[model samples]
Target: MIRLGLRLTLSGGREAAARLAVIAAAVALGVGLLLSTLAALNAVTTQNNRNAWLNTGAVTAEQEHAPSTADPLWWLLRADNFDGHLIGRIDLAATGPHAPIPPGIPRLPGPGEFYASPALGALLRTVPADQLADRYPGHQVGTIGDSALPGPDSLVIVIGRTPAQLSGDPEARHVTSIMTASPADCSGSNCRVGTNSNGMDLILSVVAAALIFPVLILIATATRLAATRREQRFAAMRLIGATPRQVSAVSAVESSVAAVIGVAFGFGLFYLVRPLLAQVDFTNTPFFLSDLSLNATDVLLIALGVPVGAAVSARLALRRVQISPLGVTRRVTPRPPRAYRVIPLVAGLLELAYFIGRRPADSGGQIRAFLPGIFLVLGGIVFAGPWLTMIGGRLMARRTHRPARLVAGRRLSDDPKAGFRAVSGLVLALCITSAAVGVINALTAEQGVPQGSASLSSTVIGDYRHYDDHGNQLDSAASPPEALLSALRATAGVQGLTVIHADPHPAPSDHLAGGLATCAQLATLPTAFGHCPAGAQTASVGPSFSVVGLDRLLSWPAVWPSAPATAAQLQNLPVDQIVVATDGSKSAIEQARTLLATAYPDQEQPFTIAEDRSQMSQRLSGYQQLADVVIAVSFPVAGCSLAVSVAGGLRDRKRPFSLLRLTGVQLGVLRRVVMLESAVPLLVVAAVAIGTGFLTAQLFLQAQFGYSLRAPGAEYYLIIGGGLVAALAVIGSTLPLLTRITGPEVARNE
Candidate 1:
């Protein structure tokens, strides 16, 4: 039976050859996409593993307070921003000669030396000493290797500090050994090395789900191409006294041949495109090419799974022929899809709506509540597609007046499930695209600057007060030394400067509003202080004295306070805040920030309004980039499935179309009929999928983020419009094949 199947598949004339070719091509495309997804996931895992050691396990308070030993190393990590980029700085101090060292470096550095990643070294060389290089407090002795860095573009530095310098810092930890994995209890700047945050993991889950579904559809659709013809042939073998098992074997052999061929070509395709895949920045940094590759196990699975799955799909599709050969020979039409097919979809929508209305408080709870709804919605689209297509077909048959429309409508009405099957992949793709685009739109739109907040883009604010872990005041400079103020004024971009004095005996209830400044001095920052209260002198200011409080104030919806104060009392106050207005240039801002860092090393870093907004935009862009890549990959796969289905449909109905052509029907009319048969069901389902996607997005946003729905951007429109046009183009390409397959030669009785 297997031999017979092989010979028939190989030399069963042009129709058989065409069928094999279409199935092979479709399977090949599906295989390639699946492999690419696997490669990308592997890259992410590889990145986390390589950088995990830096997260170094935290020591307990008891261990930290114990007697000093050379075996354990003391480490403190801080994040510093230069321009809009994040630079990781690790401060290390050794208590003895045997202190443990982290991966990818030689001996621990002495107090005056440091090590920098290659990217950071290049940056230090390019940027001025005052702006960036001087902030490190040491000379570079060596370059950190790739094993220690997450990506080629990562900026990291390891600075050597004395034991006394890190003594009282509560954030410091003593580590006897490096961690090989991310610690479960790790949080904040120290946890930046290996693990992804909860929000990032959610986005990745969404991307994976969106991509995998369409590829699965493509594979299933591929195995069923030319299914009608295969059924008749298999039924004939069943009628010839061949056992059912033998018939199944014959079918499997035929399907597996094409599948094995496709798997080989798919492997080739993945290797060819691996370099380009490496360029995609999933985590805001491009991965190394070596890291973006599949391992031995992944390769083995792909090799075995594709062919076996194809064979099984083919065998299952012939179940009707095996049970009763006469059913297929007599041309039986299957039962119409029932309304129950829509139950999952309706249930899913209701579930989502309920969850949205409830609005769970914690992130974990929200995710748990939303997962079932999300899964139901996805499953429902697939379940309800055929029923929706059937209803559309009945409406088309009832309403059309033209001859081509009449014929197309009746055919669709008869096999509405088949009509819907052709575009199922496309329906899923649009749903994912619409939902992703909608969420992205809301996130980006809501990131605009807060209202009533001052536009102090050119100003850098720094406070010179230091606090311990217990929030106890450690050191508070009454004023910046006169020499330091003179040096800052001479900086190239320094356009204006002012000082804010802290009230010596601030009331307990008004501690946050203790900073005092005269009207003339406050007027220099008209954009921020906003025309300083009319005729007021020495007004008390709000939390603009500290960088942390100022950042919060700018983003929150509150007015910047400027209540009048007595000059006599203000004069006795000490200087607490230094605000520098720069010339609104990047160079000037960096220069001013560098001066502040040099003056107050222990305080929180200074920042401008522009940097704050830029950081938010960068974070949002990462989400957008991920969605864009998924959409880009999905559309092409959907288009391929559409093309294969169109070709397969034409091959299956060749005899009927040929007879129609011979009975005085023009080829152009038949073309119109074929076009309607595919287009009507496709357009109808696409609309439903898109609407469902947008609704799901709205509910999800409201439930999880408390955000209102925002209109999608131009990119959303382009994706939808271009995808439909491309799908139509795929349908049109298969039209020429119609004239060839449905010619007068095809009208003869077998």
Candidate 2:
């Protein structure tokens, strides 16, 4: 019977063939996206694990504090938090040759030589080797890959020296140490650290999993839309003595065939796109081809699972449709969706409230608790979609006097589930985009972050690097260079120039090393800097004061200037170490910074301005770009799915529409009905989704940071409104199909 059903479906003439082809193509595209994303995720994870293994052993141990120097295998780590990222400087002799050396480096750094990460190498390349050779003591040879570190732009420098040689100060605190141990010796609880590099990969995989939900929803919607006409044919089978069970089985088989075909095509598409996925560089460096590979088991799982999922969804969609001969022929209005349909939404809201109400043990606990709430809320929105659609339909019907409005309203009321299904993908897209825009606005608003008086300048000049000019000396005791100081005071546009000097000192316990900042040169500073000590003594830079402290002291970090620098000017200024902060008029300070930078005859630009509003905006710009990419990809897919739904509806309603045309209903009214059928529900669902997203963001921000929400600007509304218009355009594209279905010949054919 299944074979007969398959043959009937496959050979059911041009219309069935075309419909099946469309369904298959949509499914294939959806599955392809899922598989490709997963493949890319796996590739990145593999590379990260390999890099971590090379960085530390398979079963490495890490202690919060460095272990005693009696053990030669433990590498002492000193983390210098620069900017927002961590730069790890590890003692290579203590770590030995634990990291796997790729073909690039012939051997590990022997004695004075050091290996830097690719990111670190990029930073080092900007500084002259002669300047670096003194402190580093050897040639800067090669770069390490991500296997050594997780962050994309993290700068890790592995110095070739024993811990004892690196530092003799016993009072100095240690941040963490990577232990070199055999896998056998570091089993289970004995291992101080979990060594498999799956944390990032797992997070990405979960996100990928979440991402597929909408794709599945889209596929199901497309299948259901395309099946509208097929349902009538199945009913005829029932009339010819086919049992309902038989009819369902045949439909399932037909769908399964299409699904299998789609899955096959999906695999091909994934394979074809592997190289493109490999090119994706989330880590700044593109992943190797080997990193992006999917295992045989994964490939098999995708091959089997997607088709099975598609077939099951098809069966479920068919459950509500009556297959009886009489029922198929007669006009039967579907019962209004039950009020219980809102139960999940209410439960999800309750869950969100509870999550928000509870005071978590820590930030981590709050985040963990909050994730489930997010899922629940999103699930609730989906669950409540049909109910919301039905209400919109009932309201529209209640208020409308026009025939077109009456038709659209009644159709929506009779089949709210279908209406919701048609635009489910749009709802998800709206929620994501709305939430992203709202959060981004709150974060990037000019008033979002409190600005200090220090930042209130038309122009500012600064230096970021503190590299030693001579060689391997710590240079912790050196004061600001007299030449640079004299030059800064001598430069044009020199307002009240504040020289914020950084002094590195050993902290007793909290950190491996610390810096002290004195607001000695400035008469006034930002309020956040507090008061400089009574004397010239230095205040230790702690968590509140670290690099973030510079922002408050009227002295920003070593920001490299954006204006072009000449070779002669660059050669004259100190590249790595110099003075920061000279404020004046825009042109004056810039010229002053240029003159100060070029004052030294043989130094690289003495200092570059590192801390400025431009830097903050640049960070926000990255976030904006990421958000735009996500929306750009998702919105089009959603729009296409909507187009499919509208097109399928036209195909399904051919006879009814034709009858309306024959009964003197205006063609324009019928077109309006079609438009409202899709547009009204879409607009309604998008509004609900967007509102939910905004409220969700508000609650989350308030709970996490005690921050009050800010209203998003007009631009955010414009973006969302643009998406709605695109959806409407998709509906408009199907008008020709409506025109064909409502023609006189359509009625005669039916």
Task: Name the top lDDT candidate.
Answer: 1
| Best model per TM-score | 1
lDDT of 1 at 224: 88
**Each prediction's TM-score versus the true structure:** 0.88, 0.74
What would you estimate as the lDDT of candidate 1? Answer: 0.78
Q: Once superposed on the true structure, which residue ranges of model 2 sit more than 4 Å away at CA?
A: 47-91, 94-106, 116-137, 143-165, 169-210, 278-289, 320-325, 362-368, 439-476, 480-579, 582-633, 664-666
lDDT (tens digit, per residue) of candidate 1 on 1-750? 889989988898877887888888888889998998888887876776776676764543433454544476778876667876778788888888999788778978889899999999999999888888878787999999898888888889998988887765656776776665542234454455555455545555766688878888898898888888888888888888878898899899999988888899888888888898888877678888888888899899889988999899988888888889988888888778899998998887888788766877665576678877877887789889988888888888899798988888888888887898899888888988898898888986676443233336667777655567677555545566767778888888777776777655455685456566666666666355443556666666653533332344344222335555675555555667778777777777788888887777655567675565555566577678778877988898889888888889888888888998889999999999889988988888889999999998998888767787788878789889999999888999999988887777788854
Pairs clashing in candidate 1? 70-96
lDDT of each: 0.78, 0.59
Model 1 residue 742 lDDT score: 77
Least accurate 10 contiguous residues by lDDT in model 2: 558-567
